[model samples]
Target: MLSNPYFKSVLWLLGFGGMGYGLMLLTEPNAEKIERIKASGSNSKQSADDQRKALFMKRLQEAATTGAPVYRPQPQVDKKDS
Candidate 1:
């Protein structure tokens, strides 16, 4: 069974995976840093989403006031008869 090429490859892959996982665990960030990172990430994401929503609503209101099409289609180009 040990002489089988497939089994050998599987064992080699498992060994490398275990070592990588162990390294990740050893080098993992402290809990406080993780929490801070999570908090900042979430706040930034929320603020970005809110800004985007506000901008979109502003544009929609402007379009409505000007009676412009909310969704504009590309203008068709006329082919020149060379």
Candidate 2:
């Protein structure tokens, strides 16, 4: 049974998978530290709605600066057109 090629391949694949999982567990602490470093770089801490408003304001400012036409579709247009 030990000499069977199919059994040997299955055991090899399982061993590699176990080793990969173990490596991920071992590196979890470093992964958390990397995440903390990434999160610390942000300047403003705003709520979700506030963040969305800020983004909208930014796009409006850009449009005004670049003279891009603002799209205002007629309310009478059917939603099916979209």
Candidate 3:
């Protein structure tokens, strides 16, 4: 087998190719977390009621310290009647 050039070269090339592929796989493993990020992004918008409550509480806190008027913002006017 030492004198057969074809067999030696074929085996050598195969071994090198396998080592390269293995290294690549090890360095960059798989991950599929895009679905979680996309789901959270869509749910980031706070509801109108929650926003109003938060703002009211903030105003109340300020009124206690500075005696400022505590007022909630007006409700949004929905233009679409359909």
Candidate 4:
């Protein structure tokens, strides 16, 4: 009955316990499967490189349309004396 103190306490405890259990399940790490999939040395990097090249080509095409000169920055490398 709704008037029973014991029944109210049990319901409250159950509600809090279920919420804590749900939180634990939600926060638990599930990244191991993703790491394992990525660890196979797949084509992710190649796809990324292809995307970058495609973007560069698109930019070049836009520059050609606008008659703009494309400049490439050189990498800074240290000169080592042997």
Candidate 5:
């Protein structure tokens, strides 16, 4: 590998070019994507609401087939007389 005359020079130039591009990125400011992300909140809320509605519909379907209530109660916790 050391027999090639341009080996060391090629590597040196490649490393310097990579560092230059990195420095350029560091000095440049990107704001459009940041603002878009900050403004993108409604989709998550909408998705969660849609999922809950779908789950409610599924439970309703099950309840309509059976005669049980769609809502189930949590198990009662027994407490000792403190």
Candidate 6:
């Protein structure tokens, strides 16, 4: 059986799968820690989004007060030239 290619492949797959499953179990987080991790992740993401929005609004406000155009037209180029 060990000399058969299919049997060898099956053994390899089972060995790898068992090792991966064992590692997963060993590293699995408890429910409380999982919840805490999730909350922190969301909080950080929200704050990051808020910061980006504030920066964008500030830039827009500056442009508005300074009478600078926010949207600029792109220069036209012929495709054949490139």
TM-score of each: 0.38, 0.41, 0.34, 0.37, 0.33, 0.45
lDDT of 6 at 2: 81
Per-residue lDDT of 25-78 in model 1, one digit per residue for the tens?
999999998999888776446676798898889989988898887688447899
What does candidate 4 score on TM? 0.37
TM-score order of candidates, top first = 6, 2, 1, 4, 3, 5
Candidate 5: list runs displaced more than 4 Å: 31-82
Which pairs in model 3 have colliding backbones? none
Model 2 pairs whose backbones collide: none
Report clash pairs, candidate 6: none
Candidate 4: C-alpha RMSD to true structure equals: 13.8
Q: All models: lDDT?
A: 0.88, 0.83, 0.78, 0.85, 0.83, 0.85
Winner on TM-score (1 vs 5) = 1
lDDT tens digits, residue span 7-42, model 5: 988988999999999999987757987777678865
Candidate 3 residue spans exceeding 4 A from truth: 32-82
Model 6: per-residue lDDT, tens digit, 1-82?
7899999999999999999999999999999999998887764456767988988899789888987766774467768854
Candidate 6: lDDT of 71? 78
Error of 6 at 16 (Å): 0.6
Q: Write the per-residue lDDT of candidate 2 for residues 8-77, one digit (tens) a residue.
A: 9999999999999999988777777988987985757677988888898998898889877557633575
Candidate No. with top lDDT? 1
**Can you write out model 3's per-residue Cα lDDT over 1-82, one digit (the tens) per residue?**
8789999999999999999999998876334556666667664597988788888888889788986555654567889978
**Poorest stretch of ten by lDDT in candidate 5:** 40-49
Using TM-score as the yardstick, the better of models 4 and 5 is 4
Candidate 4: deviation at residue 28, Å?
A: 0.5
